[model samples]
Target: MNYLCLAGPTASGKTAASLAIAQALAERGRPVEIVSVDSALVYRGMDIGTAKPGAAERAAVPHHLIDIIEPSEAYSAARFVGDAERLIAEIGARGALPLLVGGTMLYFKALFEGLDAMPAADRAVRAALEAQCERDGLHALYRELQRVDPVTAKRLQPGDQQRIQRALEVYRVSGQPISSFHTEKPARELPPLISLEPADRAWLHQRIEARFHQMLEDGLVDEVRRLEARGDLDADMPSMRCVGYRQTWEALVEDDLSELPERGIAATRQLAKRQITWLRGMPQRQVIACDAPDALARAVECALRLVA
Candidate 1:
């Protein structure tokens, strides 16, 4: 059975494009269901910042792998792969195509190329590292990583606390650098992929800025405030560490909301850059200009041609 993988940078119109593809397929009597491939969209109460499909959209189309976990709980690529595999099979059984959509390139990579056998996350060690980060700051932990795992540390920014923590945790737990575990391995072969990206970088960046401000107007701050009020979630958690959420959380704590929009937009642009880099490396993907006037029609045509 054929499947669809819709990938793109943040605010590049992957969601709308996927919906259009699914709608077109449905009109052709080949019903399709969307399976979210995003890491942040899996968490509840992170609606605005994550750009989750609203209720009207959900009611119009079937979606899975969204809002399946809480903000405090951890979700991994392995879990996403499992859930996606199951959903794919179920959708196929129902004679509908599965359309995987989002910007989480890591999850897509894991789903296509099997994950490496890295050490399991040790909560105790992770907690220790988190506590150390809180005490000595992320730079201290990054410097420590540089000392122990210079290869990994060199690739990651010092302010990237989540990755730095995970790399350090792997080293402390298994006595091996995380990079060494990234050896090539056989994985499940994915179906046709449609990658959406803007033809103009400036257009994409402007879209990112506009979307972030729209998110703020749509109550992104209030959403984060609600999560903070829960008392269990924090900036250290994977869910809260999401690009926009992290900046907003810091703004809230620092009592300086003035530059939140700018920071969020910058971080989102960086994220888009990383995603575009990853997509460039992917094989068998049809890249489309997401800002085109006929983008939706183009996406539907590409998806149909691929699956055909």
Candidate 2:
């Protein structure tokens, strides 16, 4: 199926732009569906932090693959690839265009460039990795990854604990360097691809700060409070480790922060910076410099040209 992927750094207006594009397509009487590519958005009760669309917006356009998992569960790129393919096929069967959207670079990359053939996730291995992480430190495991899969290690930052653990876990389960299995192929054989990006970092930084503040006002703290109240405080869980959520959890439990919103905003800004760094690595993407209002039109024009 032909898919249009709208991806960029956090606060780059991907969500709003994708919605607008879907609206435009609907106006043109074309079939369309928005499939989330966000890792954080998959979790239930993560709306405020993940910036999920509200009920009204979702009612206006069909959205898929959202709120299907709990914060305590693990979600991976491979699983996303499988689920996304299935969803896209189902959407296609219904005569709709699947518009992929979010700032999850790895998800987009995994969809386009196929992942390495690694063993299935072994819970025991993951448990062992977690234990190793606490006993030896994430840095030690990262260094071990460098020895085992230097290519992946080189691409990953030292503080990227999740990825470090994942690579190590793959090696442990399969007894092969995850790097050795890193073959670059399309996750799904499909039509031509179009990737949209932000053209300016300065403007995006402003948007990032503004968005975080808006999220707080929109009940991000309350969302975290609810999640915490549900007894899902396991920091090792991916959702708890989400950028804004994790930092908020930290401030709420460990640090006695009177200004919780401020703390959450700070952490979000840092995450946006890392997201910008990730986007910069994709130099080949068709980037447009503009805010949310302008992004959808730019993306639509680009998509029309690519698919023309």
- Point to the candidate with the largest lDDT: 1
Model 1 misplaced regions, further than 4 Å: 123-147, 150-162
Q: How many backbone overlaps does candidate 2 show?
A: 1
lDDT of 1 by residue, 138-244 (tens): 99999989998899999997877778999999999999889989886755565788999889999999999999999999999999999999999877788988999
Kindly report which residue pairs in candidate 1 clash with one another.
Answer: none
Worst 10 residues of 2 by lDDT: 186-195
- Residue-by-residue lDDT tens digits, candidate 2, 195-271: 44455556766776788788878877778888889984566677887888887787777656567657666676666
Per-model CA lDDT versus the true structure: 0.90, 0.77
Model number with the top TM-score:
1
- Estimate the TM-score of every prediction: 0.92, 0.84
Q: Candidate 1 has what TM-score?
A: 0.92
